[model samples]
Target: MTEFNEKQIDILQVAERLFAEKGFDGTSIRDISKEAKINIAMISYYFGSKEKLLEALIFSRTADLKIQLENLRNEAIPPMEKIDRLIEFYVHRINKNKCIYQILHFEFSSQKRSVDFKAFTEVKKSNLLSLEKIITEGQDLGIFKKNIVIALIPPTILGTYFHFNMNRPYYEEIFDLKTEQDYDNYIKTDLTKHIQQTIKALLVYEN
Candidate 1:
């Protein structure tokens, strides 16, 4: 990932917020300029085009996670513990960067195949390969089940989290979540645990 100056970072952050609130097509470069408190030329000078700006935002957001995932292969911990850490890190990242995740989730759900999405696909592919390596390590150690569907692992985690997030109002009503703190606690504890257990159920060996 390229290092962004403070000005460029501001633009990317504003763009992320707008893209999450309004669909990418609904947001214009002018809209970003207004929200970012910068001139159109500055944005153009920093990012060239709306698509390139989005591509940069996605790369910047996922860069740290990619590094962490790559490092997991070298960790001395057992593969299952590494898996747990991965879930924890992913959940934390998604919560901390909700807007970017929301935009990516929307783009994926809409199946947009623009050139920008090609960048997203590459990022996802890299993350998936990192996960596959962890799973293979577990399988080699005889802790994880063989022939697991690696492709489904990400959707399992991401899809479940996205579904819960998108339906927050409904779930809050059903669960009597009265405060933002309550909902957040549910996410950090209950929701995170559920995802960890679900993934373990898929990967861990039986008996």
Candidate 2:
């Protein structure tokens, strides 16, 4: 018998879906409970409250990303390899956490912000430190073609990713996309490759 049960994970999944579709302001304990087919008290029992549940969701996602990045940081890889690993990790993580990303996009953009998403922030800071170190080391070994403009590197990488995943819906609206899968295919093959190449071109390839 496992200590954790499906009921608990179901509640979190339901909450995540609700948060994604309706935004945090529109999602409630009853909404989650009814969608999850669990009693409202079950959520409180498992995660304390809605606010705490949201925090747990953020922490869970960030912890996964932090682990992947930390593994790359420990490996004996060049900066280019690290960048490729980061891209792969981001794509996989985003695919796994699309609901959470949707929820975050809504809640952060809306005026009714409640909980502060501190979990990803810590992970992001740690990743930036590692990226800075990678850049410095690459420069020392003459593997890089530039100086210490490390501050621009992290945001450039992250911003390109966010643009692809988060900014796609509006683009889809402007264009005539058939389905989500179609959009995803376009991004995975064309957009992702372009972004990765652009990053390498901008940061590397001296003259």
Candidate 3:
């Protein structure tokens, strides 16, 4: 993971929150300065511009994910175990970085041309490719079913988690969750297991 000094980290965190709440286009350097209790000069000195700041935030958030995925790829484990681990990693990460994921989803869905968008797209593409490799390895071993669409797997896993996270309020109401902890528990336990099982079944299913 990339390391940042305290001031830069503060600015990035504030920018992430602002971007999540307002949006990339909606946020300004002044907004981040005010929220971070830092001056505009410091932000400019550290990050150069609002767009660069967004890039820094994306790099910071994605670096760990990239490393984790690489490590999973290298680990001496069965393909099925790797898939389960990937699912669990994503569930935990999405829950922990809800705001970051919100901004990422928004940015990608916008389909605009910019440095930040490109950087985010590259990171996402790398992750998807890593996932595809895992699936391909399984197929080579005759563990995963042939003719499975590798490209769709990432979207299926991430989209399901995103849908649940985005609609938490509705879920909370429907499930009668009385506390934030209750909802989190449900996700960590039931939701995680369901996703793992679903993916495993899809991988092993005979046509």
Q: Pick the candidate with the highest TM-score.
A: 1
- Candidate 1 ranges beyond 4 A from true positions: 109-113, 205-207
Model 2 C-alpha lDDT versus the unseen true structure = 0.73
Off by over 4 Å in 2: 1-6, 109-113, 145-154, 162-180, 205-207
TM-score of each: 0.90, 0.79, 0.89
**lDDT (Cα, 0-100) at 65 in candidate 1:** 88
Q: What's the count of clashing pairs in each model shown? A: 0, 0, 0
Model 2, range 8-114, lDDT digits (tens) per residue?
A: 66777788888888877788999999888888888889988888788777766667676677778778878778877776666667766878876766666767656
Q: In model 3, what lDDT does residue 38 have?
A: 78
Better of 1 and 3 by lDDT: 1
Q: How many backbone clashes does candidate 3 have?
A: 0
Q: Once all C-alphas are superposed, what RMSD does model 3 give against the true structure?
A: 2.2
Q: Clash pairs of candidate 2?
A: none
